[model samples]
Target: MKLTYGITDKLFVWFFIIVLIFFGTILVFYIDLQHIVKISANIVNKNNEISAASKKMIENLLSMEENEKKYRLLGKDDYLNYFDTARKDFEGQLKKIVQMEARGMAISDNWKNLYESYLNISPRLRDLKKAQPSKIPWIPVNVINEWIEKIYIARAENEYEVYLATTELNRRGQTSARNGLIGIGVSSMVGLLGIIFLAYTTLRPLRELLKGIRSISQDRFSEPIRIRSKDEFGELAGAFNEMSVRLKEEEQMRSDFVSMLSHEIRTPLTSIGESVNMIAEEVMGPVNDRQRKFLEIASSEIGRIGNLLNHLMQVSRLASSAIKIRPLSIGTSAFVSECIHGMAPAAEAKRIKIEAEIPPGIPNMMADPEHLKQVFINLLGNAVKFSPTKSKVKVLIEEDEAGTDLMFSISDKGPGIQEEEQSLIFNKYYQARRIRGHMDGVGLGLYISKHIVEAHGGTLWVESKIGQGSTFGFSLPTAGK
Candidate 1:
């Protein structure tokens, strides 16, 4: 059976893993520390005690030798008593060392034997002096001194063993600390990787959902979000996809309705326009000046309705991909100059200066002249329409940085578009809130123009800020491409 992991499940698993790693690291550190502590205790309590006992034995042995020599030289019984006391202290310390060895100390048997031989030799020397009191010259003083040196060597060896044990204990402690740090570092790294993984898993779906939302907002409902996880985000994605499909169906129905309605209205609108023109021209009957003026207004309004129908038809065609591009090599400079001249009258009515900054030697582009002209006229018309009286509308033509496309920009000094509304402007039937009632358009010009430019492998974009101005720019591929 396949297991489905949700976002919460993944988070729980990662958290658990991190916790396990943390505790496991701590456990390892605890075990290692316990071992180090054990070694440390052994060195401090046992090894160090053995070393101290060896030192005391050496001190007592030296004192015994001094007292025995003094007893023979001064013939003093007090020196003999001092020698016996030192011997007893030395034996007591040796016994303590032996007991420690039996408990678990690691003193060598060879050292113990040497200590025993030294003790036996001391009693033997006392016996020899007692047996031959007048024969002091025959005393084994050199042998006693030799045994003293041997015991001193044994004590040094014991101290060296203690030093080795202490060094080993220190090594173990350092190793434990180093291993603990390594374990902690590994655990932390694992935790960090888990966090990164979890974030990626979570944010990937969110990003996809955001992209789908943006697509839907732009009226692009064809592409569905693809999130495969068994999480809440995945369920959301499924719902989002369903909504997109429904929205796409609804948009298609609306487009078809608009197209059919525009077609149904166009024939009567044309006939009405002709009739109004005929009445204004006194073809049916002679009319008064007021009647003629009203007829003229009717004619103008009829013409506007006709234009709106035409725009709606065009938008429908664009939606259905029915419009075809007839590409031709068009001269850039002359074409732009003509569009500028056509818009000059509109600019003059607004008292706006239309400035053209076309440099020489600009490359020609391959595009359908009629379609491209429509886009130019729409952009320039918007610039002239929205521009403040006496303000400047600048038309700029140039090549992009890559020199692969021709760039046209229409900048107007008008109440500019808001930043929030910029992206929505290219969407069909979407108008800026501020200009909804003030503007004359049904908001299809830029939408139609954007589609036209994009159809020719170009892009249309706007840069604007309130109270500053707006610049609508587009790029078309040059003839070389």
Candidate 2:
């Protein structure tokens, strides 16, 4: 049965070819090395034997020349016997060289020819002892040494020939090995490219699938993913498209449910609050201390519920992109004063001082007055809530670094946020863990404020350390800048 692999397994298998190529190259080099070593040994042994025989021939010739001189000086037949023995040795060495020459070994032809000519003069040299010294044809040592010189010259030439041959052989070996390595490298490179191409055909579908998955995680349900193959990846793509359609439907249902519920709850909450107010004011009847306290608790809970409902409605509107901003030119100092005035009662209740460092004659900003005030109220409220009773909350208004936007920062001497939790604090329904004490919120305040600031083409961020107080700041573009 044929087996098919997943993209991962195919990748693993394809990459394994690289490792195999490396080992294959090593094996090829080793085979080449063995061939070279064998050839080198055979050539070296053959050349060494030829060189030794050539040297022995020259030595025997020199011995014969020496014995001839001794017979001339001492007038002894023993020298002639010694000279004959040396001649026999020279012939034996020459015979060996002739056999080697027949077998195509590199022996010098000049040395062999000279030895043959010297043999022709041998009958004359034997008759030298029989004649008187004057009749010996005045045999000079130069004549005898002349043949020895020829042998030496021939031996030197043969040694040079062997060196040149061995050097040529070594050069050829290196060239062969280099060419082989280059061939392997080129083939390996081509193979690697082929593997990459094969892997790409499989990985393309996976890349698209991963992108679609990321879009889904980001709540983008309308993004479509497609794969051409009828394999497993193509089927997964089909299933992914179906899931997107279902998720989009589910999101629509959720928005509809929230809108309907918010409207239904608001009317009863207003009526209940009015009724509680009348009871507390003795319009209906005089109330006892315990009854008044219960009324206060009921009133507080009703207000909390109203705030939560408002937050939910705003979130729905924001999600649906229904909120509109009617930006108007508003004075900076005036904006800050209005925000402070609105939150003055709450700050006073905690006895927390509100400090303002408004730069005089600050530039006006283009922003929705209500939304802008809401952003400040949310930030200032948090500051007031988190600050100690006697500590101060400072609001600083200045031109931003770019000089094109006015920056507003609310800093509090409250327990700061941790570094790791900084990024999560702006997320919807996310509240940081309080180190000093518990701070309460549904986590929607920062979320709403961030959107509001972003709607004005600005940004909101926080800077804090563990012990140092936190500064929450935002920048709004100046009017007409």
Candidate 3:
């Protein structure tokens, strides 16, 4: 089967493994504690049983001797029954003591053998008790005292062995419990360390992925992430880096396509425009009014197509950063007037007037002469196109006293740009929604104009409001001839 693990799945798998290890550690400690407790309980119970049996044997021996004295003094058979009963209880106690396994109790078996010898001498003593002190050769008092002393000694020895075994059992229990606690502590520490290491390894690549994702969100696709692990994160990083590369390539291809279309298509359109211009000028023959009107429409359509193609070419160049500005000194008065003259035909058709407020002694502007002409053409053309018939389009020029820069402005009296539209007007392909009438061409003119002004170390801006006149302008720094 093929293995498929994503980031979430991989992290979960690792976490489960760690948890299982912790549980396994706990289980080991639990099993050890159970064994220790059972053994300790057994040790305590056995010691108690052994001590009880020994104690019973000692008590019965004392009772039997006292009852035998009563029988010998009173010559009573009823007292002799008490001695017989004591003897039977002693035998039972000894049997119990012998059956127990004395694991740690040394001398327990020897003590039991010595206790059995007391039974053999018991029957002879019973016979002697009936015959009186003078009839028996040996004295009952000495023999009884000797046997009782031996029984006491054996009982004490058994009690001492039980005491030693119980003490050792307690010590072993404490030792086992202590070792279990230490094992638990060590295992927990190791588990915690392992979890920390695992988290670091897992989150490291995720952090890198976040960084790369943020970069893409901000439109940055230059660098690819490099991770050299064989885990799931490594695979994900490789995929993400591949996407970044593809995005970069696609952006390049887009620019190249635009650049190619603009260059490849401009040539034939230029030839067609030239041919139409010649025929319309009557170079071939004179034309009727109806034919003339058709020629005018064709000419205008050709001019519009040519303008669109020009804007597209400029856009491709600016997008790829291939445009280089060649700045030179130029007279603001002469340059501005020539740019205004080119738009005169359009202004004349709408009965719109151009007024220049040029002050003499204005410093020559440092700019790309061709680019500046285009900038003026865009600004002046927009002002005239938006102005109503018989309205004013004013061109203003000003200079700074430091001989550093000159400012050129065009103001039009028309349905002025709204507050929101002023900033967006310079963006590529943006047209104001509150436009007065039909507008020609794509929105590249103002955008192209803005770039050209900035390339010459100047700034372009607009000032306008709805229902008020609009003024669009730029500042140009002074430069050497």
Give lDDT tens digits, candidate 2, residues 23-87.
66667677766766755764575556657866776677777778777877996878777777777
lDDT of 3 by residue, 10-123 (tens): 567766766676676567657666765665665566656656766776677777778767866886767767777876787787666565544443345455554566556656
**Tens-digit lDDT string for candidate 1 (1-481):** 9988888888888888878877887787788778767777777876677667767766777787787678778877687677767777777777776676777767766457756776665565454435544553322557556656766676677678667767877877787788778878887898889889888888999999999899877856649888888789889999999999898899899999999999899888888888888777789889998898888788878888888988999999998989899899899989999998999898899899988998899999999999999999999999998888989999999998898999889999888888888999998888889888877999899999999999999999999999999999999999988
The total number of steric clashes, by the backbone 3 Å criterion, in model 2 comes to 0
Q: Between candidates 1 and 2, which one is better according to lDDT?
A: 1
**Candidate 1 structure, TM-score to reference:** 0.82
**lDDT, residue 81, candidate 2:** 71
TM-score of 3: 0.56
Instruction: Please list all clashing residue pairs in model 2, or write none if there are none.
Output: none
- Model 1 residue runs over 4 Å out of place are 65-77, 101-157, 281-284, 331-334, 357-365, 399-404, 477-481
After superposition, candidate 2 runs with Cα above 4 Å error: 1-17, 24-39, 65-77, 91-157, 173-256, 281-293, 435-438
All candidates' lDDT scores? 0.82, 0.79, 0.76
User: Per-candidate RMSD vs. true structure?
Assistant: 4.4, 6.3, 9.4
